[model samples]
Target: MHVLCTAGHVDHGKSTLVRALTGMEPDRYAEEHRRGMTLDLGFAWTTLPGPGAVAFVDVPGHERFVSTMLAGAGPVPAALFVVAADEGWMPQSAEHADALAAAGLRHGLLVISRADLLDPELARDDARAELAARGLGSWPAVAVSGRTGEGLDALRTAIAELVAGLPAPDPDAAVRMWVDRAFTVRGSGTVVTGTLGTGTVHRGQELELDGAGGRIAVTVRAVQELGEPVETATGVARVALNLRGLPREKVRRGDALLDPHAWPSVVEADVRLHGIGGPAQVPDSPVGLTLHAGSAAVPVRVRPLGDDVVRLRPDRPLPLRIGDRAVLRDPGAHRVVAGLTVLDPQPPALRRRGAARRRAGTLAAASGVPDAAGELSRRGAVRTGDLVRWGVPGPEVAALAARVPTAAGWLLDPTRATEAAEALDRAVAAHDAADPLDPGIPLAEARRAAGLPDVALVAVALDRAGDGAPGGPVVRDGRVVRAGDDGPPAAVLDAARQLHADLTAAPFAAPDADRLAALGLGPRELAALERAGELLRLTPDVALLPDAPDRAVEVLRGLGPEFTLSAARQALGTSRRVAVPLLELLGRRGRTLRTPEGTHRLR
Candidate 1:
């Protein structure tokens, strides 16, 4: 199955031709029928014996409904361009062609409707010349008159040939079905019709309706193609799914049902805008406009790139991946001013104008190449859809995946990796310059000060930095300590030898910070000493050098296997500051037990 949309001027016989082919009136509303104009979207499907099935999305041709026309044409892969034989060419015709081209519709058939009303040769020549000027010279053109049924069979044959050459849709990729029509059936619950662009939909599969964060566990009660029931539907097929859970009002036209995990709910994108003629000349800062992609329309603030490009910030959070094609329209004039392809769907930061321009240049160059995914992955992970929007052929996307660089399942850019490494090296050098006495800066603090994105990137940088020299100081938690400096501080070393003698003579007590300060050890000195791997400062007033507490524990355990805080204080010859912290540490370590009764016992 193939989905195609019609575009041309109003009263160009678009609806008449659709009615003639499908034998179904496209004008659904009484107002449309009475006014003899298509005010809303009209849809019909036809099945040619040899060509299989094709769906027609007939859009209103008036200039006022250009936005509506865009919404219908945005998702279709091919189109049927209608031209009235008498009119030849017009402004709305050019606008429709420009819109189709901007939305990236490459395959189409030109239908010269009302051919019987004009001289056959003149009409043929005129239509061909008009299409050729729009760069659609190779498109097949056929003449038809809905009133007389003249040339209808020939037009059908031409349409069949055009659709037959189109690439078979990929059902294995992520499912992205754009809803063109939604209605309720009397017996059935709610039926939504759309072109299934990718992936297969089975009878009872749960799929998420994107743009609305809503999940409908649909039991595909029935499937239809060109009005006939079918068992399964694949990509390129126009499908009417009889959904189980959602109501008629709940599901609207333009909603997409996509693979929940494969597609992101909200993506930050980098877009390169092609200025309408050359570039928009704005003396003042650029203003915001609405960007239309697929069935989703979002208001975006445009940040211009000197003269050629612009960055867009969408107002509504949309489920757009990298490589999506969006049209930026001037909401005030309601004219499409530029077309854009998403580069980074989730960018790191929108900072540094110069850096953004450089990145944009790289993306533009990559997008113009034959292997966009490979080029993008060589830089970083790019969404597969982004590669398509960049104009790379679909078959090449999988081939480009092999070229991506991965480390522990995370993709990394070689250039970014190198930059991170250099940044870390600079950080270490800066730290060494500032704190020569310390072994090295703590890894956590180094990571914070270096201002890199992740710890893994920092680790990669450190590994690269240590390639030439002996390894620097070891890092534990957030602390940096020199290797082999696990002994007591020099001041604490002297104090420990005396404190141990004092504790042994008395039995279970230790000195406080004031006592250590009296021996020339202050807070700053103590911090340096701790970084040197010396004494552990248990509290504001309490201190312990290694091995002092261990000996004190043994003396108390041997004395009576249990002791009171008062008795322990008397034994170690210390005051409450040293006695309390020492007992608390022992209790915390489970080496000695402490009770609310103030009794201490060896565990």
Candidate 2:
């Protein structure tokens, strides 16, 4: 099915043209028919001399209803730009034209309505010239009169030709449908009417209300194209989806229904502003504007980069993919200032202008090549949409992705992959230099030291650095260690000797902190020694020698079951601070089980 929307000045006969072509009234409400003006979106279906159906979204043209017009036009890729023969061009016509251009609608036919009321030749010439001025050149124009039905056949033929030539809609990609009109059906529950961009809406598929963050499990109770029930609707077709598990109030106009996993609700984007006419000498500062994308218009604040680029921050989170074109219009002036294509929607950092530029440069370079994997090796993961914004065609972008390298399903540039591995290696070496006896740097601490972006990348880096070598153990649980460096520190070795001597002399007691301090071991130094796997500081004061055999057996033999905390403190010959940790360590080691009641025997 093919869907097209109508746009023109107020009362320019857009609705009349739709009614004339479809032989159905586009005005749904009695108030609209009586007032002779369309207040809301109207739908009509007409069968052309073709294989599929053509759906028409008759949109309101009044200046006040511009937002409504946007909602209707947002999803449709084709349009019927209507013009009244007598009036030629009006202000609303220009506004609607701008809206269509902003939304990136390029396929359309210019319909000169009320042709019978004016001199046919003059009306045709003037309409042609007027549309031409708006950059709509030589588009098949049909002069039709709703009163007389003159030229209706030609209009139908023109529409049929336009629809037939449209590129086949992609229904298997991510789902995105802009809601032009949403309401409740008596028996159908919540009905949302719009054009589906990509992906099919099956009878029982799950769809997420994107802007609202609401989930709706819909059984395609019915599908309507041009007012008649259809089995399925593809991209570029007007559709009214009867959704289950949702109410009318929940699905509003301008909301989108998309694939939950495929579509991200929040996106960070790098935008290049093309001044409407030419380059503008604009200052580098943040400015608020209205962003029009798909069927949604949102308030966004743009942080400018020099004179031409800006980082756009949408007020409300929006579902956008890489390469989606968005119009940035000055909200106060109500004029479109520029158009932007989304680069990195869901960026890691929004404030770092330098990082954004680096990413953008990488995206730009990757976009220019045929092999994205090769490019990613030099750069990083490029947002699929960003490549499109950089002027790489969709098919080419998809082709390039075949070469993209991935680790555990996450795409990684070869350079970044290499950098991550080197960073991890440097971190391990640094830790070993600082504390030779330490087992390794904690994984979190290693990542921080390496300045890696995420833990997943860090893991990949460590795994690569290890290279599955039997002798090279690059990482241990939460800690990274070099193979040869797991040796005891001098301080830990000295403490270990003292601990063993004390245990030998007083088998039932552990040494106090003063004794460990006397041997030149502090808590910070002890922690470092423990991380080095040199000495186990089982208790604050009770230091266990690394060579101690199953130390838990010694603890249980010495303390026995039902040992009191005071007795353990005295046995350790230290304060509560030292004895508590000692008891806890013994419990952990299964030497003695410490319960809430007190210590117990492991047996």
Candidate 3:
């Protein structure tokens, strides 16, 4: 189903056009009919030949009800822009035109209503020129007289063609039903009517309803599409939901029923305005303006972030997504002050000194509008929960999660991930060079060196680098490095090899510092060997073979799980300098069960 909204000047025959098309009166209240002006909003639907079912959200054309018009127009992508032939062009026509263009609406039928009252062709030409000036053009134009039924057939055909050509709605997209009307139906509780802009809404579904009061849980007790009860209703259609646990007063015209997981609500956002080049030049001192987004408009304070981007903090949290278009209006002047496209819903706080200027640069770059992954990379890493908060659509984040690795709830950008991987390699190499006789640097230190957002990503970066050829920086066991790095530097290669062989052969006895210094393998060379996993040191003087602990375990197992210190010494054939620590190492590994009396048993 497709939903189209009407736009025109006051008393320009918008409601009359809708009534002619749908054979139902659009004005619901007696006051509206008697006054011949739509004070709120009205809805009517009909079936088109090839496009199936369609609904028309009849919006008020009076300047007094401009906000009501914005509420009706936000969710409906297609429009039936009505202009009375006799009037040609009017004041409200321009305001409505600004609203449509601001919303980025591109599909519709331009109607010359009450054409019998004027020369149809000339009026159409004038209307077309006026619309083009407002940045709206190329829609099929038709002359129609609702009272006389003149040219209604051509109008229908044009509407059908427009709806047929509209981009297909994504049923799997997140549901954001912008409620424009709410009421009570006796025992039915609160019945809210809205345009289901995307995704599908089903009966008995629980969703987050975001409004002035913030988010609250609501259930759809029943759903009606085009006046018929249905289990589900897809986007681009009008839906009335019988809601449970919400008062009619709480379900206001601007409230939104949304997918709790997909549609996150925010009170403030940074946006780039279109048409007028950018949002109205809001000042450092905030000013009140109406912010229109998704069948909702709330009073907001506008502040300029840059020439092209402005920050809007609404009176309440709103369900917003990147690329969603909105209109900013000065109610006093009844003029479209600006038209905005959401750039960042969760903008960085400008609390630090010079943060505003720095963020202005980011906003400038964002105006180029990269895709989801590119934005993520530019930010380095974003908390998974904040993807939508930054105005990225939830569906995009979900798709990205499948493609990228999310470690510890942050989506690591592919480019930044590569940089971090290289950084990790460099940090390990630097540590090994400075402290030659130690294992790899701690994960915390690596994270700090790379300026990583989380320590979890340190391990992830190495895992992604994969195991290298026997002796690369990839030599990681848990958080420690098993120093089998490619090889030590040219200056220490000979000394490093000699130290390794000496430690391997001796297994239990480590050479003294004086002996190490004499061999030209100082503290650094020893640390480097340890990083390469070629040398294992139990103490400053006692370097042991890598397999020494396991060998001790084997001998102790054969000794019937009971042995004294001297007995263990004889088994390993080493003195207490090596035996004591080795025995402790064995006990620590759970290979030997040490009793309170000091006897050791096989664990």
Candidate 4:
């Protein structure tokens, strides 16, 4: 299926051309028929010989309704640009032509309508010249009379040929259908109609509706195409979705139904305007304009970056991507101000005084194409999925495997990898200097020190630093450790050795707080010795050898299976304070069990 929108001046017979081709009325409102002019968007479709089904979105062409015309034409890929023979080229014709060019529409058929009223050959030549001036000279022209049906067959054939040659859209792409017509059906609830440009929509598929009120989850209760209910609908086809979990008032004509996880609602972006050698010029900085894209017309504040580049900050968040074409209109003048091609949907902030001017130079050099490596380099690192949402194709992201390194589902720039590795080395050295007893840095702290987003990236930085290199950073257990370094400093180790000697000589003589402090064992040093398996801490102050519990159990077994705390202390030759917690620690280790009466037995 193929969908095309009608564009031309008001009363240029755009709707008439659609009616003649489809044998269906293009105008839906009574006011439109009574006034004999298109006031809003009208929809009709017909089955072509080779194209299967071709849908037409008839848009109003009056200068007042240019916004309405853009809403219809923005999402459709091709167009049926109509111009009456009697009125070869009109004001709305130039505006619509500029709009279509601004929309980046390359596939279309120029229809010279009402040929019976005048000689269409002359009109066709004149219309072709006018279109050429507006950058649409490549489209095929057809002379047809919608009233008398003159040359209708040729027009249909031209449309079929134009649609058959259009670039195929990916049915597997992410869905981002803009709602051109949204209303409530009698019993089906809210129904939104739009031309699906890519991806497929199926019944029961959950989607996110992004609008002025922010994002909300909605389910597709049903899908319909050409007035027939269907299990699924693909791109380049007109679809009417019966949506559940939303009211008619909430779903507006400008809202979009997007794959919930595939789009990011953004408010600011850097863009290349069709400024130089084009019909429109970039407006001055901080000027108010209406940005039209994909059936959405949002008020925006434009900051002129260069002669042809700008940064647009929309009043509301929009689902935008790089390379997407949009129109910027001066709402006060009611005319197109500029046409834009998005360069960066996720632009950096212009905080410094000259940042905007400097950024303009950078954007001028950008290719305005989806570049995974370029984006990754700009951000240093980003989620793989985020690049996809930024308009980089999944295949391109996968192909970046050789150019970019991924850690914890994030793509890391080569330069950033080097920076993070150096950061890791500094962090390890700092941590070791600050606390020699426990030198290895915690993984979370290492991630922060390296300025990496994820803790898992610390390992990647370690690997980048040549993890096992002599004295280089490496991860031991869960902490980031320096390579080739044995335990604590020599002085701390000497103190630990003396403590070990004391504990070995008297197996159960746990050191008191003052004694341990005298031996230079603080909480940190003691915990380090404990982690090294050299000592066991029965309490904050009481210390013992790692095997003291085993030797104590043997001594208690000599006193029979059960013994009182006092008897145990006497047997172990330790004081009551040290004996109390030691007995409790033995029970906790399951080497001994405590009776209800507070006597203990070996387990």
Q: Could you tell me every candidate's TM-score relative to the true structure?
A: 0.82, 0.78, 0.75, 0.90
Q: If both were scored by lDDT, which would come out higher, candidate 2 or candidate 3?
A: 3
Determine which window of 10 residues in candidate 3 has minimal summed lDDT: 466-475
Error of 2 at 467 (Å): 3.9
Candidates arranged by lDDT, highest first: 4, 3, 1, 2
lDDT of 3 by residue, 59-114 (tens): 99989888989999988889998888888778888888888877788787789999
Model 3 stretches with alpha carbons more than 4 Å out: 120-123, 276-285, 301-305, 311-315, 345-370, 382-411, 422-441, 462-603
TM-score head-to-head 2 vs 4, winner: 4
Candidate with the greatest TM-score versus the true structure = 4
Residue range 374-490, candidate 4, lDDT tens digits:
888777788888889989999889888556667778878778878988888888888789888887888888888888889877777667657468888887788888778687778
Model 2 lDDT tens row, 55-79:
7888898877876787778777788
Which runs of model 1 end up more than 4 angstroms from their true locations?
A: 184-191, 212-232, 241-251, 265-268, 274-289, 331-334, 348-359, 368-410, 435-445, 467-475, 479-515, 570-575, 595-598
Decoy 3 TM-score against native: 0.75
lDDT of 1 by residue, 1-603 (tens): 778888885762889999899888777788887777787888888888777777888888888887778878888888888888877776778678767756656688888888778855665676567666555667877888888999999988888888888888777777777776788899888898877877898777667775454554445677886677878788877788888877778777657777655565554566665433335332233565677777666677766543545566676556566567667776576566766666555555656748766765655553523366454544443455545544456677656545543333333455554565555556656766675445456666666654544444455444444432444333344543333334344655575566556545654344555676677656655566555555566675455665657866866765587788888777776777777778788888888886677688888
lDDT, candidate 3, at 68 = 89
Query: lDDT at 419 for candidate 3?
Result: 80
- Candidate 4 wrong stretches, greater than 4 Å: 121-126, 279-282, 303-309, 348-365, 399-404, 434-438, 527-534, 549-564, 583-602
Task: Give the alpha-carbon lDDT of every model.
Answer: 0.67, 0.67, 0.78, 0.86
